[model samples]
Target: MKKGFRFLLKTIMWFMVITFAFVVLFKWVPVPVTPLMVIRYFEQDSEKRTFWKHDWESIDNISKNLQLAVICSEDQNFLNHNGFDIEAIEKAFEYNKKGKRVRGGSTISQQTAKNVFLWPQRSWLRKGLETYFTFLIEVIWSKERIMEVYLNSIEMGKGVYGAEAAAQYWFKKPAARLTQYEAAAIAAVLPSPQRYKASPASPYIQGRKAWIVKQMHFYGPFSYDKK
Candidate 1:
């Protein structure tokens, strides 16, 4: 029993050490494997797709509309929550019970943690890792950093990652100049961007855009600076 306990402790310590190392390394390194980058590599060969890479300083950076739209669509109480929002989780559970796959309680921080560091899958183990990383990022990163990473890493289309890519692809403009409607359209397809095109012409896309616009007004502003 003593030996077994020692082995488990050592294993956990090693895992923590490795995780911390990667976190520090990636903080300085531009991660090469964004969702859209990976998809583009496989879908149409990486050479064909134009992957927009911009740091936070680009004037056409992610607009306030884009940020607010994401908050409104993903987590209304993102500013108030810690790593997890229990009330939103419970509400999501109740909503799902009613035959509606209409809710996810993930805050911007949690979403950024998953998008930047984890893979796409639904498993208890993956979710556990997500929670762990979510906690780590929330503790280590500011709310602005979380929002910036989320905007930069989210999958906007098959070969599109980040606001700049999506903006250029969909609206033929830069990300910083995206209108509320354009931002809403981008945020609306976030749930299944690979499947749903981010254009305003499709009926379902247009309806989703409108719904998100309504939600934006309902949720109001997210003040990350305050909390």
Candidate 2:
């Protein structure tokens, strides 16, 4: 029992050490790829050739409109939270408990952690690791860096990843050049990137885009400069 306990302790210690180093390394480096990207590629039909598109753009190069649009559409408290938004979590929990459609309360920071360090499946272990990585990133990375990595790594459409790639894929323009409505359209499809179109929108995507644009207006002009 003593030997087994020591082995478990040592294993956990090594895991923490390695993961911490990994997170710190990514603080400055661009994330090359994500687990979700790989998983999605394999999930495609093997009979047909599959394509993957991703381009890394610095936070400065990505449009402020897109940054703000995602904040409005996904996490309004993104700028204020310490990696978690308690109120949103509570609401999602209550809503799910009431037998309504399930919703996620993840903050942008939390989503960044999962996208950068973990997989896409919804297991308790994955959730726990996501929380752990989220704390690590919030401690080691700046808000701008977190947003940069998030914008550069998240899946935006089928075979499309990141703001840069999504911009070109959907609008035939670079990420830095996307307009407010264009950015909102991209953000509107985030809830189900693979299932929805970011351009030539269906009625559902158009309505979501309108709502997100309204929210972005209320959010006002956005800047990542520290106040």
Candidate 3:
């Protein structure tokens, strides 16, 4: 029992050292690839399944409209929360208990951590690791850095990641040049990017885009300053 306990403790210590180095290293340098990208490459329909468009744009390079749109749609309290949104978590839990339209309350921070470090799984272990990484980034990275990484690293669509790539694919423009409406449309498809089209205007996407535009206005102007 003592030997097993010692081994487990050593493993955890090594994990912490490695993860801390990784998070700090990524704070300045762009992440070249993520676990999700690797996972998607393997879980493909045919050979050369992954067709990635990962242009790592700096936070200032991406449109503020896209940032606002995502904040409005995904996690409004991103600037306020340390890692998790308590009210959203409570609401999601309540909704989940009802067994009706089940919901998730993962903050952008959480999603960033999960997307970069962990595999896409609904397991308790993944959640636990996600919590750890989320806390690490929240503590180590400034709000702007977190927002920068999130905007540049998330899966915008099938084999498509980052704002730069998404903007180019959907609007044939650079991410920095995206208009407010275009940004909102991208945000609208975020809930299920692979399932929804951001262009040629599906009614569902249009409706969600309209709602997101209102939310962008509702949330009002904000900045990603350090808290």
Would you list the C-alpha lDDT of every candidate in the order shown? 0.77, 0.92, 0.90
Clashing pairs in 2: none
Model 3, range 92-191, lDDT digits (tens) per residue? 9998999777699999999999988999878999999999999999999888888899888888888788999999999999999999899999888887
TM-score of 3: 0.96
Off by over 4 Å in 2: 225-227
What is the alpha-carbon lDDT for the whole of candidate 3? 0.90
> Whose TM-score is greatest here?
2
What TM-score does each of the candidates earn?
A: 0.83, 0.97, 0.96
Q: Summarize candidate 1's per-residue lDDT along 1-227 as a digit string, tens digits.
A: 99999999999999888877766665555555655455445666557765444333232367889988888888777787887889888988888889646677677777777787776766788789889888887777667767777787778876678888788888999889989999999998998887988885479889988988999888776667766
lDDT for 195 (candidate 2): 93
Off by over 4 Å in 3: none
- Please identify model 1 stretches exceeding 4 Å from their true place: 1-7, 25-29, 35-60, 100-102, 218-222
Higher TM-score: candidate 1 or 2? Answer: 2
By lDDT, the best candidate is 2
**What are the per-residue Cα lDDT tens digits for candidate 2 across 1-227?**
99999999999999999999999999988999999999998998899848689999998899999999999999998887889999999999998999767899999999999998899889999999999999999889888899999999999999899999999999999999999999999999998998999889999999999999999989897655543
Clash count list over all predictions: 1, 0, 0
